[model samples]
Target chain A: MEAQKVLTPSKREQQKEARRNAIINAGYQEFALQGFTATKLDDVAVRAGIGKGTIYLYFDSKETLFQEVIRKNLFPIRDEAQSYAAEFKGTATEHLTSHFRRMYQALHQDRMPELVQLVMGEGLRFPEIADFFFREIISSNQELIQGIIKKGVEDGEFRESFNAEFTQILIAPAMVSALWRLQLEKQSPLDIEAYADAHIEFILRGLKA
Target chain B: MEAQKVLTPSKREQQKEARRNAIINAGYQEFALQGFTATKLDDVAVRAGIGKGTIYLYFDSKETLFQEVIRKNLFPIRDEAQSYAAEFKGTATEHLTSHFRRMYQALHQDRMPELVQLVMGEGLRFPEIADFFFREIISSNQELIQGIIKKGVEDGEFRESFNAEFTQILIAPAMVSALWRLQLEKQSPLDIEAYADAHIEFILRGLKA
Candidate 1:
């Protein structure tokens, strides 16, 4: 009688969300271990301890599931970075440096590196996923950096001639470093901390009023 | 008698070199069209007008043949860029910008972009090729640029505090732009010329004494 009272429509909706979250968590692990091409929904279902039909009910296809993995797991980092930036009170240089350092930490400590490898390596074959990543991740970060640079210019912290459209200039070093660590670090390891510091120094020198 | 004279050891050596070049040229086209994994020696032989056995006679494996393609076709462009820098007399900014512009041209107009994609996309699975690319191509370019930065600082064209070991900072924009062109341009196209100009402007301002 107690169970029946708790199993209302709202309770059923909560259960559905839990099931969806379980599938997404399993999907991320499977994709990381074997990559997108090799992963199977059945394996994902088994890993999640959900029925195959139930997995299908939640996700229409493997591609959809992968998209959710990106949205649910990776997109929140952007939000965190944004919130951290919003709460901070500092010079643009300090803010930029700290933001990038946090990004580096997140990239290394999380599954973000594997996700990056997947996009760079297999992205061409799957254009929709690549587009989604670019829109949700790449351009969003670029816009964030651009805003910081613009604010610096307005406050006379950076040179007035600084062009914000070139935010890619600010973002490239981190992107390259991450890709290097993912693919080529075994043969030619870079000290990423030093690399990031030097990048910050270089950009600050360029932008400093 | 004429045929026998033409079949002398020196003549045979010349013939061998010619055959090797032909095979490499064909191999590059095949790989570019079909990528590294799907490419086969039989097609390379047909393209080169050599028998399949002869392909093995010159190259023990497809990977070896691909490495030679990189060495023969791609390495000389680095030498050309270096020579361009060596002969130039200009400010550090001018030299660096011109050198990068040439690199941009080479990357886009030549086969360098294709080679980059092959290394990034297929490299983890083929450690030998990845190592060869890193040692021969990546580190060499970094060293070349580092030398340029050192020369600039010594001449007092750039700030004395400029860190030269962060050569990757200098190289990243071009590398990222090339990869973007190759992989994501369809969805998010960048005007690379404008992008390169912006990058140069940003770096030169940062470095200018």
Candidate 2:
């Protein structure tokens, strides 16, 4: 144990990298368990097996660490949405539905429920985080939905006067909460993918066809 | 001040009522200003101009006191949703649209945003409240929405294949955040009434005969 614990210059850098990862993992657990208000840097440091000073070497503040946790998790998923939406071409509703199916599947994945709770629960305290979400995640996906709906209407796949932006807003919250709710329950009548399929079907039925 | 402060038994009762009202008002302010975990009963009592014991006479606990504030303000409005929904008779879409319009207005009312914040912020820690809300509010309304959609499909006012339950799920969540976002400096354009109107319209267009 003593031999393995020693670090040279290059090994010190590797140890630093391990400490950074440990801090992030510890922060994620703390944020989830205690929420933002109750969580403390000291607790996180203890969990990470690092000193208060070592924790500072990687991140400046609790807020910054939490922000990075959010960024690390959110941007990749958002990028996934972009790539999925980009690959489709067909009826606007169909194209949009494919993207939603993928997004819904991702959202139904285990980590997302905790993330949703963190965001929805804490977003009120930090209005800026809500802004970040709207700008970086919701608004972009909404625009893509709007574009697809617009194209659908234009191509005579949907009714000519269909309003895409409004539809996105109308459908978004339900879609966001549905999976979260299903997870909250012990046994839902439907799993998330089934719910997503049903949701897309429901939306298609509601939109101007 | 002399006349108001006079303490006959009748006057004593009046003063007690006024003080209780003051306490509840103070509680709401404190809870909203600092959130539940940070808010102290002493601050509430101080703001109310009464002993904390006086607060106990009027309300059983801090949780109860907060619940009372919410119940007093919101229940009447919430109760109206059912009666309003009960009165409508038309095409299924028309009936459902009219029902949601009332709900949109109710959830969008100024009282609801802070109340919603209170629910999400504190309610996560106390899931009993969320459970009560689900039983008292969402469950009944969901049934009504589903019933209408079911009837509409049967009558051919909507597409015969309409997914009744998930459609209601889709109807929620967009307008859910409206009132809370109301006082924010930069709100999403998807507002309560606008989103409701758009949703009702979209659903109609998608399902219309």
Query: How large is the i-RMS for each model, in angstroms?
Result: 2.1, 3.5
Worst 10 residues of 2 chain A by lDDT: A179-188
List model 1 lDDT by residue over B1-209, tens digit each. Answer: 77767776576788999999999999988876566766888999999998999998998888889888877877888788767777888766677888888888888876667666666666555678778778877777877777777778888888777677677788888877877887678867789878988888888887777
Quote the lDDT for B36 in model 1. 73
Q: What is the C-alpha lDDT of each candidate?
A: 0.79, 0.68
What DockQ number belongs to candidate 1?
Answer: 0.51
Query: What is the DockQ for all candidates, taken in turn?
Result: 0.51, 0.40
Docking class of 1: medium
True contacts kept of 1: 0.59
lDDT per residue for candidate 2 within A1-209, as digits (tens), equals 56566644467778877887888888888886677777888999999987877778888877778887777778888897788778876678678677777776676665665666667667546777777777787777777787787787777776655455464544564444643363335322444555666667666666545
Best by DockQ: 1
lDDT of 1 by residue, A1-209 (tens): 77867766577788998899999999998876666766888899999998888988988888889889878877789899878878989988788888888877877766777776666666555778778877888888887888788888888898877667767677778777877887788987889888888888888887888
